[model samples]
Target: MKLLRWTPLALALLAGAGTASAQDKPDPNLARNLAATCAGCHGTGGRTVPGSAVEPLAGADSAVLMQKLRDFRSGARPATIMHQISKGYTEAQLELIAAYFAARK
Candidate 1:
């Protein structure tokens, strides 16, 4: 019957959706992912990047980092690279990434 065939397909889709939602955890690996993107310029874990002017970020103050991020996102801070990347990221993701790095020590 048409109804029976559709019912199985609908159930399979629902099951797949539920599994995906379960996998969407808060991302404790925030530091790892963020570091990968930043390491090219900022160095890993606050180490100074070779031949780069960017400052270290591993043990920076959380408040300071948060403020800087806000500034970058709002055009208050004048950074070419950060402004571009930060613009596309959500506030929550920014906070998580900032906190992950700030709490490194």
Candidate 2:
């Protein structure tokens, strides 16, 4: 009876799990290039730099990351470092960067 009960529960869980991955599609090329600038703080190969003051961005969400970049570009989020860097980027470049990081696994 225990084995029979467990089978139904496991099948339900497996069905639910499949839907979660359906929405997680990411672009490959963008993720690769965006990695360059990200490496400055987050470390190369998506690893966080040891004892670095900056927070790691290895697996951050794409939409959230894009909005942050947009905010930095617009002077809405006011970080001196980000403000300076964001100013140098074009809108296209920003999109590419956002797409790249968002694609990270």
Q: After superposition, how far is residue 99 of candidate 1 from its true place, in Å?
A: 1.0
Off by over 4 Å in 1: 20-24
Best by TM-score: 1
Taking all chains together, the TM-score of candidate 2 against the true structure is: 0.56
Candidate lDDT scores, in order, read 0.79, 0.71
Model 1 TM = 0.77
Best-performing candidate as measured by lDDT: 1
- Local lDDT at 68 for model 1: 92
Candidate 1 at 90: error in angstroms? Answer: 0.9
RMSD from true fold, candidate 2? 14.0
- Model 1, span 3-81: residue lDDT tens: 9979989999999999999788766676568656777777777567557689878888878888998898889999978
